[model samples]
Target chain A: MHLYRYEENPLITPNDVPPHHDGFEVIGAFNAGVAKFQGEVLLLLRVAERPMSDDPNIVKAPVWNPETGKVDVYEFRKDDPRYDFSDPRVIKEAGAERFLYLTSLSYLRLARSQDGRRFTIDDRPFVYPSNELETFGIEDPRITYIDGTYYIYFSAVSPKGVGEAMVSTTDFRTVTHHGMIFAPENKDVLIFPEKINGKYYALHRPVPRSNGRPEVWIAESENLLHWGNHRFLFGLREGKWDSARIGGGAVPIKTEHGWLELYHGASDDHRYCMGAVLLDLNDPAKVIARSERPLVEPEADYEVNGFFGRVVFSCGALVDGDVVKMYYGAADTSMACVELKLDEILDSLVKV
Target chain B: MHLYRYEENPLITPNDVPPHHDGFEVIGAFNAGVAKFQGEVLLLLRVAERPMSDDPNIVKAPVWNPETGKVDVYEFRKDDPRYDFSDPRVIKEAGAERFLYLTSLSYLRLARSQDGRRFTIDDRPFVYPSNELETFGIEDPRITYIDGTYYIYFSAVSPKGVGEAMVSTTDFRTVTHHGMIFAPENKDVLIFPEKINGKYYALHRPVPRSNGRPEVWIAESENLLHWGNHRFLFGLREGKWDSARIGGGAVPIKTEHGWLELYHGASDDHRYCMGAVLLDLNDPAKVIARSERPLVEPEADYEVNGFFGRVVFSCGALVDGDVVKMYYGAADTSMACVELKLDEILDSLVKV
Candidate 1:
């Protein structure tokens, strides 16, 4: 498949987004949800920030303490046998059953582009962590515009476990927060732009504990608050690019062929790539077809080397005419954009 | 405080309940939910059965296959490096992120008793694995008699994850399944017998992936199917008898002073015991008091040795006057009974 990468790729970096506090530094500004409003393209970016430590033996972790209602930093000695810092992204307690703490905290920030490439970032965060469920932080925002409202769905992370939560805003100035719509150990939730068969439908990835890999599951809701009628939509393919795990990406675009869904999948080696799946337009649960190979791989230098390497994850995309404008997070560090033809993606999908 | 153990301590054992099939053996007949129905005491017992293999090198795991709609046995070599069988209850995959499969499949069976001590076991399962969510099995039932219906809440285990599911019955003949009431990584959900302030309340333990330990959480529901208004009720007290992890046990018994709740807590050494928690009668979320020491410890031989040793877990109890007839699972192997005085138990709680 032929794809076009913008000349000035890596559209937004950590340096472009300011830290939330005085002692913190922005580590990542990526994994944005793309949307169009008021004749401008908007990217809701996930900005990750971490507290700085001067001592070589000490590492700091920021946590939202619900009791004191403030963000607190926990300092751990690198020499301590109890604290396992093997994973750069998290600080795990070394024991039989693991307890995890993020190395950095993440929240959503807004960026706008008139030309769909160059952009101006908002001074303040679009959405920040507030509740106990968001004690660790929030990550990965997906925007779905329906009627006159823009519904923003993101992953709420805490010691409680990662779950999906929603918020809504029309002008992007004020926000109305909706409490957690999904329980813990779940993320990558994307809502359909329009109701299907008179009910609101959503795609979610629930990470299993005992068995099963993370796969996309569909559920329908009445008021968009309480969700039910859960059915497993699809799972990982054997000996394929997405053999490890898979999740729902960009709000599925409606087409004559089917509901075109751009999704992210990982290999056994943790290499992330974007793939496509075609679901029946009327019945979103029915899978019509899916990609045999990745539509976008982590081949670019920006995508191959960053905070977390070998990843190209997209949460949102915008379709104009036959051109699909895809915004993805490169290596969990910086934001980048690419363009793919609608017909080319559709043709690439192997029939089930 | 003084307590009395029933003369026939283990009222039901694996020898009393027949295996589900030819090659299968009833490994466990415990963790039963006690209820007073008609003129007899009913025990909804979690009967665990596993396929027996004569080959000393092979371990068999029973799994409910969604595709075949049947229970299938998976055999793994004891010498296989990919499979880790160190944990007696579950088989874990050996590398990176682990996948788990149960050594035995569990389903609920019914046992009827004229007196609260001696019982007769049912021939068929009261409730068995039916859907994909319960592929692993259904376990640890907590029955609450509300109005005329008995609400049987259980932990539905699958590769998807362990979550709480509900089933209701007026007569023991048939049941109405209420899908999953709580999502994955959560279990030990106990619903109150009746509504308080026009809404139903339940206590649950959601095992966290990241930070928090498994603690008791209270949630209120309008329909009992969808829960909301979640609040952290209580957690483990450091250096106490109940320190490692805690979960709701028998349904809360409403009393004149408050609501008396029996909860199971595990120590750092994995010794399980039962403790008491007192909550506000009107608002169950409000903590009134809790036990500084355990009410029931694994001191008996049956409770100290079996499938899982040093465990005493209760799901249901019958409150007759000032006597609390508690039926508990001893070491995950047999059903046992004990009686505690309500006044003595209530006085043992240390005021919070």
Candidate 2:
């Protein structure tokens, strides 16, 4: 279970990132992917920014133009019946076909830490919206080092839906995008550190139109582009903290027992928490033991304040002997860290 | 504008179609496609049927099995909050991805008419859902006869989404399915009677998730299987009866003025009505003139009382001299007929 929080709990905040060139404010910098590349600990942080407007009725979002390769602002008025703004983070258009658009823009930023606690942030963004497919923005990156290649998997947002795209980088500066690895209505795609039984495996969440159940699924790939033999990994537990939905977090850590996976789960009331799931090493699709209780929920003021409240979302973590260092987003507004003893987490996992 | 209604307002009702072999009840038979073959007029009717359940809390929809060649029922509990039953015809599953399922089973039936007013209904269904793609049953068939072949276009529904499919037949009894002419999130397809500029053109409706608009689109085909060269035909008008959504009706009727299209439109309040649009003869995508008002709304008791109230939607219309005989569905429950003088409708169209 996640126990001790760092002395300086709020590791990263909105003020850490520079303001937008278009007079926008940095809303948050959280949900960072922890990685150790080239003898230095790296954090790929998801930085959310919102445009500044004089009128209270107007809301703006960054719209990507495929033709000119530029991001333009799309404005929607509050009084318009065509749009429904029930949620602060999302705006739903009213008509025959439903479309949900986020109010803010999210892009990845880089940060480096020597002690894995104190970090130095980069001024420039690591990734931003480029094509019409990424009209909304890229978000929530999870890095996996496989065959000397760091496969940075992130959610690609567009009008169609949230899909998973991967960019591979040997050196941190330059990366090659492999395009959309997962189709629309899918998110939280995480690749394993190594191949399982001579095949690449990934954990993804598909929001099925039927049943309305967004469950975590495992899929095997021969070329990584073409994925098949999908297997249902696990589903939400009724009358539990994770009764709504679940997604994979961080690359799976290999152990004698199984592949230890730290995952994020949300309750019906939208309270997010972390949990551990142990998968069979050979057959990663097989669910072994799952946490009966949340590893950590929003208990601190920083975890329950600003933007969306009552949230603790982990993007990635680093394994060091029996200790697991987790870098997570708090309240969807800022970044924080917590340490979990690897053996203690493995012991806490119980069969449901 | 829908000047006269047939004395027998509801030409075909639940009593007309045979009940399911499994003690189910026939709900309604409406939205018939019109065609004149072998000196006799025929109407392809979409007959909706459902199982008579003892429990009021349980809702059931008939699902067709391609392998078994039989219809099986799918049930949902009313107590589950996952269902959005606000719309009487469609029950939407709520969550990340939205899916709308019909409450009744619809199958096409053959009805022959001598006077075009009184129709003799057949006991057996002419066309039923025969594939996994059509598990939700076929609906809203529009017929276009070209080169001695009748192309029947209808909306096919399943767990995936609603799509457009077609069947070609020389003899009405024998039909050859072309298999999903248009992919999911699309329907209401009406093919043209002849090739336009050496290419086959079809009118379709695609629900774009980006804009939340379900607008009518025109697409051309070279081999009928491969479709391309798509053009936006028209969309919903604000503060109007057709403000919610619109779809193509009968095949384009060529006139000296232009090619006249009779289409169905629904308002946000779920009021369905018929409308007219005039398109350029050579370039069918170019909208020349449109009716400022709906041709007909729910007026008569037959069109006012049924499964879905306040609906008068047409699938096909036949032209004989200056009289346009329109066959339409009433209240989404029963079939009816109305006649309009060609000169009157043409004069009614405004350039706005």
List the DockQ of the predictions in order: 0.31, 0.06
The alpha-carbon deviation from the true structure for residue B265 of candidate 2, after best TM-score superposition, in angstroms, is 11
Who wins the lDDT comparison? 1
Clashing pairs in 2: none
Candidate 1, residues A115-163, lDDT tens digits: the string is: 9999999998889897888999999999999898999989888876777
Question: Quality of candidate 1's docking, in CAPRI categories?
Answer: acceptable
Worst 10 residues of 1 chain B by lDDT: B222-231
Candidate 1 residue pairs in backbone clash: A100-B210
Cα lDDT of model 1 by residue, B135-185, tens digit: 999999999988899889898888777778889999988999877777666
lDDT of the candidates, in the order given: 0.88, 0.80
Q: Residues B132-176, candidate 2: write the lDDT tens digits.
A: 668888898989998889988888777655666788899998999
Ten-residue region with minimum lDDT total, candidate 2 chain B: B222-231
**In model 2, which regions exceed 4 Å deviation?**
A20-22, A53-60, A64-71, A74-86, A91-101, A208-211, A228-232, B1-352
Clashes of 1: 1
